[model samples]
Target: MKNEVITIDLGSNSFRVLKYDYLNFKIIDEYHQVTGLADGLIDSGIISFEALNRVVEALCIAKDKLNFNPNNAVCVTTAAMRKAKNSNEALEYIVKNSGAKFKIIDAEEEARLTLLAIKYALKREKIDTQNFTLLDIGGGSTELTISFEDKIYTKSFDFGIVTMTQKALKDGKLFEDLRNQEIVIKEFLATLDFSIKDFPFIATAGTPTTIASIKLGYSYFNYDKNVVNGTILDIEDLENSLKLLKEKSLEELVALVGKGRVEYLEIGTYIYKLFFNVLEKSKSIVLDDGLREGVAIDYALSLK
Candidate 1:
């Protein structure tokens, strides 16, 4: 009989439950909720009570969604958990309430696991994995992985949508008169020698995929994997999306970007534009699968 495993990915912005069939090597079911688990982690250096409760509530929803009892599930926390000053306390609270043991993974391991998701998805799509770069922008960090000339290289950027937004545009405005922000991005990009233009670019994770979905006019949370995965997103789409988003109020933005994702969507767009602009090629392939899928894949492989 095929073994079933549930992977609960505790992300900075959302909590996701993925039911993976190890024997089939595929995700059979998935659930997502934005609990803002890292909302104030950057400033306070601890997981806020609100964030903790949000996670707990999301966990309850996930637990009830599955056919099997959720006690069999394996929960894991990412960058947000690592940054919290009281991570141990936060995790203990989670276990006490959720009946799930959460594992905190390191940065390098996180990057490596993200690669697994891309590799698996690309293989399924029959796309060329020979020479490409993956830009994974999450809530708390971005993972950049490049495969050039048969060698794979990876590095993680500590800043993500939330951290970058809070740092640069905390005024709760989108793309203000800050010509200075471009210089910041440019300087940060300069530290990395890889050319985005030379290789096939693949953007994974919430921010990129969300931007891609929005451009495609997919209703919020109505994302279709077939329509989204391996789809090309134009640089112009980022510009137009940002322009449209800049015009909306918080309530309206939530309706458009989906609840719980509005906070970082604007910042996500700017970050998207920053990376998309660097590519000599004007478009990028969007992959819906990312760290969560990677975690499932890694776990499945370990059992082999």
Candidate 2:
């Protein structure tokens, strides 16, 4: 019999739930809803009651979709929830109202699960991962990991698409401040001393992979396993896309990408541009899987 596991990932911009058949090692069902958990966190340093209510509603919907009991589900919150001043309050509210218990994962754990997802995704594609740099860009944070000779070194940055756009890009300071930020990021990356020339870079999260899909001209945003496993984006093409998006207004951006993603797309593009500038010599590989899949993997391992 196949054992079923449910994993809920509460992110800054969206909430996602995955139901995996562990025996088959495959995702059987998935659900996503945008709750914008970070909407007021940047300005207020707390998740507002309105946002909390929205999340609670989403969680209820996710719970309704689950085939198993609430006790059998594994829930986790990342980035935004971790940094919010009212995170504990929010968590308590969810437990009280939604009957869902969630663990707030730290940066180190975030990195570890991300690597697991990367490794799993790579193995699924049968891609060689002897040398690669993995990037996971989230709404409230971005994680970078370097894998060399079976060892992985990871770092987490406070800079994320939501925070970056709210703090920097909307005010037109992103370009001016980008170089200084890049210098800092470059310095941190340099400490790892892993040669970029020897490895291909892998990117996960909504930003890069979505951009890669759009660049490839997918009519709908499906994570084609084929596209994610072996897809590569040219630096020039990515830069061009970012440049085009930068010229558009908020309404224009929304029209081009979709509602609930315009601001993120703007900030995500800026981050990618910085990533492109800093790692000029390396090529990029797209991965559609990340933290949610990582959580699912963790749950699968736990049952063993």
Candidate 3:
């Protein structure tokens, strides 16, 4: 099937791969693994040897799942690779070892693709995206896009769950770190002239989806996109969840959530809380689809 395509989305916290059939416009197989690529990026300003190896190992596993042939795949990396000083080395190592070519996209391109995914999800949920705002939270950066009549406003922030955890919260000052990041979010949000209250908010990417799953009593192993796609993520609900998450020790947190999530779950959830409060939204629709969907769509179209 020439219409079949594979897309790999490399993130600071995880690596995701999906197989899509352009002919049917359906995703056939999906895989994700947390490699903690961002954990070593903050202080190092480069991709550490260990982090690069972890991602390459994950990519190799992904290749096997896709039958060890991903030549037809569209492999792209996001904020971490785009911002890391040693990104080229890390990507090249993957190419050398795994035979998968990775393209690091800029912030604008990242936001644009995420918006496309939001539109796809909205159509499925029978919602209008013409006047809506989309938030795509990643492990290394956050993207916000607002669409209105004949115009669009978009911005990408440097703060992300894994990045924020390594950069801010590791020093035992969780609230202080959150307050600082919130200031950055608020100032960037204030630049927008659009009436934020006019449009409903939709959030894409892992943080919200994971939060939605936890709120609905599920985990990564038992996650259901259909259940989360149109779920409401409220600020108050997350505030309560934060208190619960904070009480757990590191080991307990990982036991509760997965190892990939425990370290930064609190910060990620808090960021969600900050977004709702700063944007003046009590709750937002959660979308499980993300950049991977957008990548699949684009790769599918390019197959023509």
Candidate 4:
């Protein structure tokens, strides 16, 4: 078990802990909790006491489940912590209550770690990794990464499903907001002075994977990551999935994608659709691997 390592990806919406047997190159155990650490963070510049408690409780639960030393685990917090005004105090509280030491990584480092995971995943899937655009949608930010031979470029946007939904609902401009975001991203790309057309598009994270699950006719209760990985999602299929998601009520949405995710799926799908159109990609491969996997990969690399 000395070769086993733990990676905690404390995201804006979800908190995940993975026990990886790096020697065998496989995940031995994993824990996922929808802590919603970024919930209500848009209006309040600080992490609320309730949100902090939720994260701490989840961390404690994951610690017991995996029985890993908190000091040994590589735990990384993303956008929520980065934007929180009281992040230091929040970290102190989490460590005191749960013994989980977490680090807040910048967007650039976040994208780099995520790229490591995506690259490993693509190689495992027998897909070409020389050229591809990766879309990683989180709760507080979305990262669009373009990877070419020995060079990778990434731009992180502030609006993710959680923050986007909060702002749009507060302003009553969901459609307009989505359109504005799409325009902003396109403009940012234009400034890069390079074309992204013809690059293989790959998306990792909850939204695309959830849509793939629905397309495969698997409910939240029966979701299978193995089948979900490497799934190809065409633009037409995404549109259809959006329509289908919109038709479902909150209860039905929960039945399909789980509780913590129901409210944001529709908006997430809208963002996914916008990115596909912006990238001029008709189809994209969806992968379930993400930050947690990337952290594990980096830790394993460090040992070597």
Best candidate according to TM-score: 4
| Ranking of all candidate structures by their TM-score, best first | 4, 3, 2, 1
User: How would you order the candidates by lDDT, starting with the best?
Assistant: 4, 3, 2, 1
Local accuracy of candidate 2 as per-residue lDDT tens digits, 1-304? 2577888888888788888887777988888777888986878899888888888888777777765555557888889988998899988987887777889999889888888888998888788767787888889988888888878788888878888878773577877766777887888878975576657778887777667767776523454545645588767767766786768777765555656776687678778767866877446888877777888888778778
Regions of candidate 4 where Cα sits further than 4 Å from its true position: none
Which is better, 2 or 4, measured by TM-score? Answer: 4
Writing each residue's lDDT as its tens digit, candidate 1 over 1-304 gives: 2587888878888788898988789678888898988887767788888888888888888777865455677777788888888999999998888777898988777778888888899999889657887888888877777777756677666777877776664555445523454555456557666675667889987777777777778857577777889888887878777787778787876776788787787778777776666444578898888777888888888988
Candidate No. with top lDDT: 4
Query: For model 4, what is the error of residue 216's alpha carbon versus the real structure, in angstroms, after optimal superposition?
Result: 0.5
Better of 2 and 4 by lDDT: 4
Candidate 4 structure, TM-score to reference: 0.96
lDDT of 2: 0.78
Q: Provide the global lDDT of candidate 4 against the true structure.
A: 0.89
lDDT values for all models: 0.78, 0.78, 0.81, 0.89
What's the TM-score of each model vs. the native? 0.89, 0.91, 0.92, 0.96
lDDT of 4 by residue, 85-119 (tens): 99999999989887788999999999999999989
* lDDT over C-alpha atoms for residue 184 of model 3: 84
